[model samples]
Target chain A: MCELLGMSANTPTDLCFSFTGLTQRGGNTGPHKDGWGVAFYEGKGVRLFHDPQPSCSSPIAELVQSYPIKSKTAICHIRQANVGEICLANTHPFVRERWGRYWVFAHNGQIANFSRQPGPCEPVGDTDSENIFCDLMNRIHHTLPRDAMPEQLAAVLVELAEEYAAQGVFNCLLSNGQWLFTYCSTKLASITRRAPFGPAQLKDADVTVDFEAETTPNDVVSIIATEPLTSDEAWDVYQPGEWKLWECGEVIASGKRQR
Target chain B: MCELLGMSANTPTDLCFSFTGLTQRGGNTGPHKDGWGVAFYEGKGVRLFHDPQPSCSSPIAELVQSYPIKSKTAICHIRQANVGEICLANTHPFVRERWGRYWVFAHNGQIANFSRQPGPCEPVGDTDSENIFCDLMNRIHHTLPRDAMPEQLAAVLVELAEEYAAQGVFNCLLSNGQWLFTYCSTKLASITRRAPFGPAQLKDADVTVDFEAETTPNDVVSIIATEPLTSDEAWDVYQPGEWKLWECGEVIASGKRQR
Candidate 1:
């Protein structure tokens, strides 16, 4: 299992403050130090970076920390090796083209005996995570209408996810430049920040940030993770077999636990 | 990248309606058949299953489809391969003990050079995903106060995630029996369902369901995915850098994307 990090905000914001603490887990504070990656949504486009190196020491990671790319959404991960050999191709936050738009994904859990004949979408690496992304694209290309509604597509995704989860562990985060979708079988947690911004402290490194100084009274920000990243903020824990759909930094819908 | 499936409802709902369609992608329709897994959250606990086989043909997966394990939340996944060898140890929906509760997680992306000396927490398998998960636990154990608020913890998580994202791909889902946190760096999409119910069809498989027939007027559900899963529903895409905190089937807070 790997660490997952996500953010959604009502206003364009920088994740640098929060990200600073997360990177420490890549090696300094945690174990997920194989390689790391992150993607930032800017308007209708995305800025992505990946490296097959420990985030704690990766110069690229350092660069990201110093750069304050602003957007409304972001996803990041630090890896620890489960499937493919360590390499850049096997990095998380895998990106692809779909419906003329770019799609990105990252996972923290492993699937067993997962093997599929490559479809038109091919994996750049041997990781099961990348292969799964390709296969999902292939399915979307083959099944969805050119102009499908988000709800309709979500239903289809639910169907697909159910099938996959039945075969093994299936907690994940997915996005397509419009909204963020999350599904958890186990070990998922989240925190939402709105209006009354406050102070926060990092658990990975000796760092702190006063969100009140960085955000506005109308700003709404949310953060998701495999575990709580701070020592002072409140984080909600996702029940096993729970999921939610998010748009514009708010959950428009949700589901009950699947037993 | 991996395939994700999620179901939420006012009442405990069985995912059979959607699982039927998603299973096709495990092998017959898509390529995420490396292994499959599913978890149904029953109240505070979770019922999980993992198979090192293609969901399309896995007997376990078939059993899951047939079993109407109903709950408020459910998560599923189909793997393609990225981290460790395709085996049970590598299967996802990884579970851990935290704050006197069980936590679960699954992933769809890969990390590059995530190598860290395992502390008290160690990966059961060789997959980067597992390693990351264990690392997260180790960090949480040593960092967060056992009685910290969920929101405070989330702030810390955001910081850590930003750090990991700097290193490489980091898209993921995490839960701890109360809330779901989602982070998107590249590709993630989500849909929320509430009040008015409608009919839905799967894109990969010839399957359809009428929410009006299966859900109540007060039912609110959400589904998250890497891509839109249906051909008709409107799904919101996540920005390049965004994350959301979800609770009770709704988005409570979100984070902004920073490049």
Candidate 2:
């Protein structure tokens, strides 16, 4: 299994504090340390940093932690390598362009006996995770219109998540720089920080941050992870086969399907 | 105009020496201070770094120069905006997947009044260079099979280059990691180093490298740029209507057309 981290915000926000906590699980506090990657959505552009090294020791990950890259949406993952070899080619998260927009996807957990037809967008790596991403793209490209609304796309995405969850674990995070989408088949959690936010301490790392000092009252920042990253804050845990569409740090649409 | 830097090597090599010289042109030594990007291929995966800030002073570029990310092939560019705004989306060395292989492209010249029909692949940025790349991919997708050979792709590539060159300038370098294809519309130079390699001095930056000490006798390395990066090395200058197919640092096929 692997760890996933995601953030959606109303304004440009940096994930230094949250990312610092998550990096601990990559090698320090957990066993999910094989490779790590993060993608920060900067308007229509994405600043992606991928390291095929354990995040705790990766120099690139350290740079990312030390550097404050502000973005509206961000997705990160730390892998443990269950289905693929430990190499740069199989590292997450994977990115491809669809309808002139870059689509980024990262998966956690494994799909046993997973197989699919070759799609218009093919997987660069041999991982079942990348294969699922390509399959999803193939379906979306055929089903959605060139200018499909995010809400309209959410229905198909929910259906796809349910179908994949039926086959196996399908927890994943996806984004197109405009909106963020998440599906949880096994494990997922989230916490939204807004006005009246208090101090929160990381569960894995000995670090704490006060949201009151860091944000304005109107600022909305929501973080999603494989598990609750901070101990003090109450995280909203997702039920099995739950999916959500997020924009501007708020869930625009959400549902849970019994698989 | 922009400055391009590429490498094709028989063995995995680092582009720190050539990249350092190119970085100087991003702001310090040349007029191309708009943006810079580089793509390093590790097996089937590509590590891409893009910064809209000038490379000479960009912190990300500094890390890239300081850290040695070795690769068998690399494509880099420093852009002086002509048809697009100074932003990450418009940065050169753009990447996309075609038939499971990531295709990287960078252009040094402008295309005046260039337009093309939309295709399977699309550009996230509004640059003539990206449009040309998209058009090239559309044509290739329609005309070639998924497993087209590099040599077979070369013929169509040359034709596309000529068609784009007819509009204006179209100096560009493209690679699918397996092979490199270069088209010179105005200015491009290449230097291939093997045994008996001596010291080389950068033309723009105050730096020198002894290739004899750095490379093995059997190592074959080729560096291509908008201009000869080194003042002491003998570079093969490409004519206005010339194209070459390179693999393992050797030119397998070459041709020219009267314009």
Candidate closest to the true structure, highest lDDT: 2
| Total backbone collisions for each predicted model | 185, 0
* TM-score of every prediction relative to native: 0.50, 0.97
Candidate 2, after superposition: displacement of residue A257 in Å? Answer: 1.0
What TM-score would you report for chain A in candidate 2?
Answer: 0.98
What tens digits encode model 1's per-residue C-alpha lDDT throughout A1-259? 6788888777788888778788898988888888888887765445666667899998667767876767788889888888987766577887654543546788777778776544446665677777676677678777789577778777766666666666677777788767877777667788898867788898888888888888788988888888998999888898877777777788766775556
For model 2, which pairs clash? none
Per-residue lDDT of A149 in model 2: 90
In terms of TM-score, the best-performing candidate is 2
Q: Whole-model lDDT for model 1 versus the true structure?
A: 0.73
RMSD values for the candidates in order, in angstroms, are 27.1, 1.3
- In model 1, the runs with Cα more than 4 Å from the true position are B1-259
Model 2, A15-115: lDDT tens digits are: 99989999989889988788899999887888889888889988888889888899999999999999989888899999999988899999998898788
Q: How well does candidate 2 score on lDDT at residue A122?
A: 90
